[model samples]
Target: MISFDKFYSLFQKNLQNLYKNSKEIESIFFLLMTHIFKCDKTTILLKLSKKGKIHFIIYKKLIKKLWELKKNKPIQYVIGKAYFFDMEFIVNKNVFIPRQETEELVYWILQDNKNTKNSQIFDIGTGSGCISITLKKKKPKIGHIYAIDFSQKIIDIARKNAKLHNVKISFKKVNILNSDIPIQKKINNNSIIIIISNPPYIRISEKKLLHPNIIQYEPFQSLFVPDKDPLIFYKKISFWIKKKLTGIVYVYFEINQFIYLDIIKFLKKIGFFNIKIKKDFHGFFRMIRAVYYKKK
Candidate 1:
């Protein structure tokens, strides 16, 4: 057994060579300790203040997790879960870990449709079902929610998350770029439809710019797009909305800040209007929302 303070010192020391920022290292340590201890950070700190001694078995587990972190594994994957919109989600290498910016996207959707009734939401490329599950949880009265992804493995992970959250989301294996939109023929004229996605927007060339942790641990299918057509997913989705969906539709996207202007232009060209861009906490334009009216 070792004193909590000493254990934390050892933990920080082992991570120092890999993580340069002291605060970041500390945050990682807290997440690991909380996961291992199955308690909140406040309780962990209280134990540390009282010189808590960690059992040898627990210490061994902590060391193993630390080693995983040192190998550039994402903390979320290392821990097997992530928190989004203040809810816990099951995550793994098969799915893209949820981002804080996406919470803003969810907030935007809920804000615009707070009083909406008989609405349907579709989450495209919904890895881990974070967006679709969250929207359903926040607005249980929404008529129906659907989420689709390319990989059955990814869809399975997303279904697990939906079950974990106890939210009903229709999960489907779909190659969004090639598969026919599954819900296209089910649209009800009087019902509002909201389509939202955080699709692959990072150009493959930008891979070098990302941290090894992200590039190494997250699924490439969820992250990278060909540089020749970084907007491919956006274009496909816009085309789907233009040709398939109808009547009082709203669309939201977690966008690449660098190409937001290009996205807005394309949406306008496809007849989506009332387009608005929202800046995330980092002050980058990371989300877009637009409205479309289709006459029957």
Candidate 2:
């Protein structure tokens, strides 16, 4: 058995080399304790004040999980779940963890559609189904929500997450990178079409700047684009929209912060107007919105 203080001391010492800030180490420690031991901060503190000791066997289990952390495995992957856009999602090595920045993108969409009703939505690269599921939860009146991903393993996780949220979404396994991939079904001509995507936009050359926790644990294919073609997914999605849809189509993307201007330029070149850019919490221009206007 070990007292909570002693256990915390040992944990901090073990992770000292990995994390430079004491507060970061402490925050991760509490997150691990709450997540792994199923003990919230108050419960753990109360127990520490009263019982003071944790079972040696449980201590070993905690150590085992922390060892993976030392190896740079993300806490969300290690625990098999992540919180995104105010909802909990099941995540694993097979799927990319839903990010807080993407939550900003979701907030923008929800805000824009606050007055909309019975709308149709298509979410491309719906990793863990976060965007579509959150939209359905917040705006239940929206018409059928459709999501697609390239990996069957990722789609499986996304399905489970949608089920967990008790939101109905049509999930499809399709590689949007394939130019020949057709839209699954034609949307109603009069229905409002809202497209959302957070495709892989990281340049391959920027891989060295990423933390090991991301590169080592998160799925690589979902994070990187060829250095020579960082705009490939954006271009493909833009071209597909032009080819497939008509009437008013609102498109949203959680983008690479550095390429916001390039996205605007590309959208203009492709005949998309009413372009808007949004900043993440860090003030990076991390999201873009545009509307395709055509009179029929």
Candidate 3:
């Protein structure tokens, strides 16, 4: 058994050797203690004051997980869970980790639909079903929520997450680029339908600039687009919007910070009228909301 302070000091020193940023070191420490050890920050602090020692078995497990982190594996993947939209989600290498920017996308949708009744939501490329599941959890009045991803394995994980959150959602396996499956065929004319996606928008050319944890561990197909076609998923999903959306169709996307203008232009060309872009916490243009109201 090792004292809490001793354990923290040794673990942080190990992380510091891998990460130059102190904030990252501290954040990882906090995450590991809370998520892995099931001890909150305050609890850990209190334990430190009392010179509490962790069980040797738990300490050994921590050391093993840290070894994976040294290989640039994301801490979320190492722990097999992540927190998004104030809820815990099961995550693995098969899906993209739910991001903070994606939470902003969820926030915008929740705010827009705060007063809305009887709404149907479709999430394209719902990696972990975070967006759709979060919406259903937050706004229980939302009518059918459907999420799709190309990988059946990924859809299974998303479905599990929805179950974990105790939210009802439909998870489907469909490649959005080739899918013609109409979502929610029997919606009432007055019901608002929102479609949201946080598709792969990073350019392959910019791949090297991303942190090793993301590029090395997160699913490559979910993080990057070909340099020649950075907006491929956006364009394909936008075309789907043109096809299947019949009601007051509101579209939301978490986009690559660099190509938001391009996305805006594409939406305009595709006849989406009321389009808006939003910035994330770092003030990067990371989300866009557009509307296409069907002719009355």
Best by lDDT: 1
Q: Residue-wise lDDT of candidate 1 within 1-296, one digit each (tens)?
A: 88899988888888788778999899888888888899999999998999989899988888899889989998899999899987999999999999999998999888988888778888999998988888888888876888988999998999998889898888878797887677746667678888899999999888898988998889988999998999999999888888877787889999999889999998898788999999999999999999998787
Cα lDDT for residue 257, model 2? 82
Better candidate by lDDT, 1 or 2: 1
My TM-score estimates for the predictions, one after another, are 0.97, 0.94, 0.95
Write model 3 residue lDDT over 1-296, tens digit each, in one string.
88888977887777787799988877887888887667688887788789898899988988898788878888889888989977999999999998888888888888887888777778889988888888888889876888988999999999999889898888788887777746654778778888888889899899878888898889998988998989999889878777766757888988998888898998999899889889999999999999886663
Question: Best by TM-score, which number?
Answer: 1
Of the pair 2 and 3, which is ahead by lDDT?
2
Worst 10 residues of 3 by lDDT: 177-186
Q: How accurate is candidate 2 locally (lDDT)?
A: 0.86
| Per-structure clash totals for the candidates | 0, 0, 0
lDDT of the structure predicted as candidate 1: 0.88
